[model samples]
Target: MAKSKVEYVCTECGDVSPKWAGQCAACKGWN
Candidate 1:
Protein backbone atom coordinates (compact mmCIF):
# COMPACT_ATOMS: atom_id res chain seq x y z
CA MET A 1 0.00 0.00 0.00
CA ALA A 2 0.95 3.55 -0.52
CA LYS A 3 0.46 6.57 1.65
CA SER A 4 -0.53 10.09 0.79
CA LYS A 5 0.74 13.31 2.25
CA VAL A 6 -0.67 16.80 2.63
CA GLU A 7 1.04 20.09 2.01
CA TYR A 8 0.53 23.43 3.66
CA VAL A 9 1.66 26.91 2.72
CA CYS A 10 1.36 30.43 3.97
CA THR A 11 -0.85 32.61 1.79
CA GLU A 12 1.04 35.68 2.89
CA CYS A 13 4.33 34.09 1.95
CA GLY A 14 5.41 31.67 -0.74
CA ASP A 15 6.57 29.12 1.81
CA VAL A 16 5.48 25.72 0.61
CA SER A 17 5.92 23.27 3.43
CA PRO A 18 4.52 19.99 4.67
CA LYS A 19 3.43 21.31 8.03
CA TRP A 20 1.20 24.18 9.10
CA ALA A 21 2.67 27.15 10.89
CA GLY A 22 1.21 30.12 12.69
CA GLN A 23 3.77 32.50 11.29
CA CYS A 24 5.76 32.27 8.10
CA ALA A 25 9.44 32.04 8.94
CA ALA A 26 10.29 33.83 5.72
CA CYS A 27 7.60 36.47 5.58
CA LYS A 28 6.45 36.26 9.21
CA GLY A 29 2.70 36.20 8.95
CA TRP A 30 0.00 35.15 11.43
CA ASN A 31 -1.49 32.69 8.99
Candidate 2:
Protein backbone atom coordinates (compact mmCIF):
# COMPACT_ATOMS: atom_id res chain seq x y z
CA MET A 1 0.00 0.00 0.00
CA ALA A 2 1.07 3.56 -0.62
CA LYS A 3 1.55 5.95 2.25
CA SER A 4 -0.61 9.01 2.39
CA LYS A 5 0.51 12.40 3.58
CA VAL A 6 -1.51 14.55 5.91
CA GLU A 7 -1.69 18.32 5.78
CA TYR A 8 -3.42 21.05 7.77
CA VAL A 9 -5.05 23.73 5.68
CA CYS A 10 -7.06 26.79 6.60
CA THR A 11 -10.48 27.02 5.02
CA GLU A 12 -10.85 30.77 5.35
CA CYS A 13 -7.51 31.83 3.88
CA GLY A 14 -6.20 28.67 2.23
CA ASP A 15 -3.07 28.74 4.33
CA VAL A 16 -1.14 25.55 4.94
CA SER A 17 0.06 24.88 8.47
CA PRO A 18 2.60 22.43 9.80
CA LYS A 19 0.26 21.37 12.56
CA TRP A 20 -3.39 21.61 13.44
CA ALA A 21 -4.61 24.45 15.61
CA GLY A 22 -7.84 25.98 16.85
CA GLN A 23 -7.22 29.16 14.87
CA CYS A 24 -5.41 29.90 11.58
CA ALA A 25 -2.25 31.97 11.64
CA ALA A 26 -2.71 33.60 8.25
CA CYS A 27 -6.29 34.79 8.60
CA LYS A 28 -7.06 34.09 12.27
CA GLY A 29 -9.97 31.92 11.27
CA TRP A 30 -11.26 28.91 13.21
CA ASN A 31 -10.17 25.54 11.91
Candidate 3:
Protein backbone atom coordinates (compact mmCIF):
# COMPACT_ATOMS: atom_id res chain seq x y z
CA MET A 1 0.00 0.00 0.00
CA ALA A 2 1.12 3.55 -0.65
CA LYS A 3 1.43 6.03 2.17
CA SER A 4 -0.39 9.31 1.96
CA LYS A 5 1.19 12.57 3.02
CA VAL A 6 -0.41 15.74 4.29
CA GLU A 7 -0.10 18.98 2.32
CA TYR A 8 -0.46 22.61 3.29
CA VAL A 9 -1.06 25.66 1.11
CA CYS A 10 -0.36 29.33 1.54
CA THR A 11 -3.32 31.60 0.99
CA GLU A 12 -1.23 34.64 0.12
CA CYS A 13 1.13 33.13 -2.44
CA GLY A 14 -0.48 29.82 -3.34
CA ASP A 15 2.49 27.86 -2.12
CA VAL A 16 2.28 24.12 -1.55
CA SER A 17 3.93 22.41 1.43
CA PRO A 18 4.41 18.82 2.41
CA LYS A 19 4.12 19.56 6.13
CA TRP A 20 2.36 22.18 8.24
CA ALA A 21 4.26 25.34 9.02
CA GLY A 22 3.69 28.48 11.02
CA GLN A 23 4.60 30.64 8.05
CA CYS A 24 4.71 30.30 4.28
CA ALA A 25 8.14 29.90 2.77
CA ALA A 26 7.39 31.60 -0.51
CA CYS A 27 5.32 34.62 0.50
CA LYS A 28 6.25 34.54 4.18
CA GLY A 29 2.62 34.65 5.13
CA TRP A 30 1.38 33.40 8.47
CA ASN A 31 -0.73 30.27 8.39
| TM-score for each predicted model, relative to the true structure | 0.58, 0.70, 0.71
Q: What is the alpha-carbon lDDT of model 2 when measured against the actual structure?
A: 0.90
In candidate 1, which residue ranges exceed 4 Å CA deviation? none
Question: What are the per-residue Cα lDDT tens digits for candidate 3 across 1-31?
Answer: 8998889989888899998888999988998
Candidate 1 similarity to native, TM-score: 0.58
Worst 10 residues of 1 by lDDT: 13-22
Q: How much lDDT does candidate 1 score? A: 0.80
Best by lDDT: 2
lDDT of each: 0.80, 0.90, 0.90
| Winning candidate number (TM-score) | 3
lDDT string for model 1 (1-31, tens) is 7788887788886788788877777888878
Task: Estimate the TM-score for candidate 2.
Answer: 0.70
Give the per-residue lDDT of model 2 (tens digit) for 1-31: 9977778999999999878998999999998
lDDT of 3 at 16: 99
